[model samples]
Target: MAEAQEDEKVGGFLGWIERTGNKLPDPVVIFFYLALVLIAISVVCALAGLTALHPTQVNADGNPLVVMSQSLLSGENIAKFWVEMTKTFSHFHPLGYVLVVMLGAGVAERSGLFGAAMRAALGNAPKVILTPMVALIAMIANHAADAAYVVMIPLAGIMFHAAGRHPIAGIAAAFAGVSGGFSANILPGQLDVLLFGITEIAVEGSQLDPSWTMNVAGNWWFIFVLTFIYLPVIWYVTDKIIEPRLAKTPFSNTASADESVQDPSAKLSSNEKKGLNRAGLALLLVVGVWLVMTFGPGTPLIDEPACPAAVEAEGQCAAVQRLAPFFKSLVGGFMVLFLGAGWAYGSAVGTVKNHRDLVSMMAEGMRDMGYYLVLAFAAAHFVALFNWSNLGLIFAIHGAAGIEASGLPLPIAMGLIVLLSATLNLFVGSASAKWALLAPVLVPMLMLLGVSPEGATAIYRVGDGATNIITPLMVYFPLVLVFARRWSKDFGLGSLTAMMIPYSVWMLVTGLLLVVLWVFLGLDLGPAAPIAYSLPGN
Candidate 1:
């Protein structure tokens, strides 16, 4: 009854959000509409002579170059759009990155390696530390991508039930870590590749820093720290807040006899054990290969020979330039790791008898991405249209100017960015889609204000993650609700949203504080990625 009152209270605001959000069109349709709006706006801005002083470019007179907004509705732009439509979608920066990663991820997930690995991590955890253990594994399981939601959430519920705790508490902890801590993983994964790929495009389009390139590990340290920060947050929220609230909520045993037969406490079978062993070996072998390629023989991943003589004469090549190849190679490296590990594990467990099965798994993964492909097409055109119109850069320059004139501290400015991202997440759930729309403006705007693109990306991630669990718009929110319903039949959408509210609030606060601290300390975002950026001439 207390839980009912609590749900009603929180549901008022979130209910409005859910209703309004459901009324909106699909993300792909949203992109198409946004593109149409951008065209109209571009026509108006161009006719009104909107322009900005280019930050990096100079005229023949050595003055800052003045850039005029171009109308996307113009004959030239319309022609270009029609001619380049295919190229735009095909060359979309994140398209290949996500597809490539999903190929390997599909095999690993289908072969049951990802599920077994998550189960193994939480299988024997002590009751005393079960919340933290679930939190930790949930964060790490982000490498499994969307599979984490399917495998970990229910498994956590079962594990908690077996431990005599409220299963909802377990589900909350796992959901918090999986979605709320989405970007807080120890190792760089597909999200890094996807977001940073967008960041790279934004930076290049802005022409803010010609030297800036995408580093998949650019947020390694930030996310590594975030993992620890979120671990305690989830642990405390689960044990101290959510569990107490859920304690009186009666759990209805909804499982069938066959479903109940698969006890989570049961030990792994011999085949599962053998598969895990082989998977570990295969993973290590992949790492070993990357290590040798990076550090041995000619050091192929390093570009010492390509160092400019001006820098080489000073002693060594710039670290970032030298290690560029290694960073670019990590995308493929991760694919190989998942592919090899899954294949090895599947072979040991009889999931993969030959190459045909492996190919089938890869194809299945691609099939899962059909929706993303359609969304990507619309998003690619929208982004390309924005870039061609020159409005993204114009707005960024003007926005940066306004921010600078306000005399706001950089940390405060970044905190606002995080807030903006969190608020937007309630409305727009796809991280890549939101980033696609925001990056061209936010990345370049922050860059103009002396914040690194990486810094902007990092903060955006923090905001994007914190509100995911509470937002009905998030693609997997319904799936998570279904998982919760299995343990408690009365668990409605409001119940799930209310249960996750504390996690969302705490995570957003914690993440904002961390971003502020990171900016004030001037810490590196990742290897060779700083929190501060400067225009080249500056």
Candidate 2:
């Protein structure tokens, strides 16, 4: 712990940078360490020839390290590492995946659409149902993909204040549900699709069946089951546990004027009312169209035509393909839907003068992500280099090997992994990056040890998510610090840490126990994904 503190305190220049923004970590300095450490590791691995190692053993799509390893050691190979690093910045999902999503999200956030909607939705719920309701909403928001973080955190406080509860308790409760119950949700989410894609890629590496379909629904059953389990526990902990502890703690006074009580669904003037009605009508039309396409056999939007079954069964009773990339792209299209709806409302209501304002809203939305883009650039490179070093793979292989030797039950092993990931969270924050490094080794290792790739992925999810709120290393940790400063002027790093530690400890224990139970019960973690192994990859 002291060493961790010292590490945070290191480099005299960083201290100066910290003074500039009490809430945000100096990304420039963090990136410096990320680059330096990763580069050093890459160099060492190159010299030792350890760069060639990959945990999965199956090669094709190859590990993230593959290109970097081939390129980093010799001067001639430099291009390989640079190429992988560059792709992260060019993220190809139209307006850049992360950027575009954040764009729409930012507008909804900036315009107070998210905040207002959250308060109105939660505030109106019976006070007794508040905890469970928040937990359920958190689980549902998983499908919206990180919008909960952008929208729910502040919304929670607002709703709690409006309901006469401790606002921090509200924040903690919502954070607990969104993050703590991350692996458990009633709906398929970005995680379901992302992990399924990766697992498919991993399975392809073994070449038994390169085209096996793993849909977002693979983990559906398990997640749905866990959602119910999480609701009560989250409610109990929030109302009976966390809230009591934080009762004496003053709520942070960061409420904005825009957040003041106002009925979002209030009666509008003729023009405004017309605009909102038009927007609502358009949304209904869009939804109606989508529903028909999804339900209709042989509809282009409903099936993956290229897949043999999809084509052979075209117009047949079993041709649904909800997990297709085009279908999944709808993930961010919510922004477009909202934009159209909002634009219509604005036009009729006179909130929008013209198309320029619409464009401006989007532009303004994306502008806030400039800092995130910079951070992602350095982070992408650092991750690329770390993959090149092969250290993560080495650690994964060793960890898996140790677990295999113990002859532990699958649940016990998964429990251990959850613990390991939670411990690592104390220092690491990026879930995707951490999982990218972890998945290659652990996924296949578990496959070898009688755990399915889906199961392994589920365990990894549980492990990664359970520690997020408590970790000071989390980028948002310092923001929580700033929130604290509003309530307790003397707030510092230690103070925020002390405040969260109890919540963190109890969550880590309860969440991991939940994972163990899921494994024992043979539940489906999500659609098509089973919780245990039926056969080895070979």
Most accurate candidate by lDDT: 1
The segments of candidate 2 whose C-alpha lies over 4 angstroms from its true place after superposition are 1-71, 82-96, 138-168, 178-226, 245-287, 302-353, 382-402, 450-454, 477-499, 531-537
Candidate 2 lDDT over 303-327, as tens digits, reads 4555566556574322224345434
Off by over 4 Å in 1: 1-11, 253-262, 308-310, 313-317
lDDT of each: 0.90, 0.58
lDDT of 2: 0.58
Q: For model 1, how does the per-residue alpha-carbon lDDT over 81-174 read when each residue is reduced to its tens digit? A: 9999899989998999989988998999999899888877888899889999999999999999877998888888888888888888888999
Cα RMSDs of all predictions? 2.6, 7.1
* Global fold similarity of model 1 (TM-score): 0.96
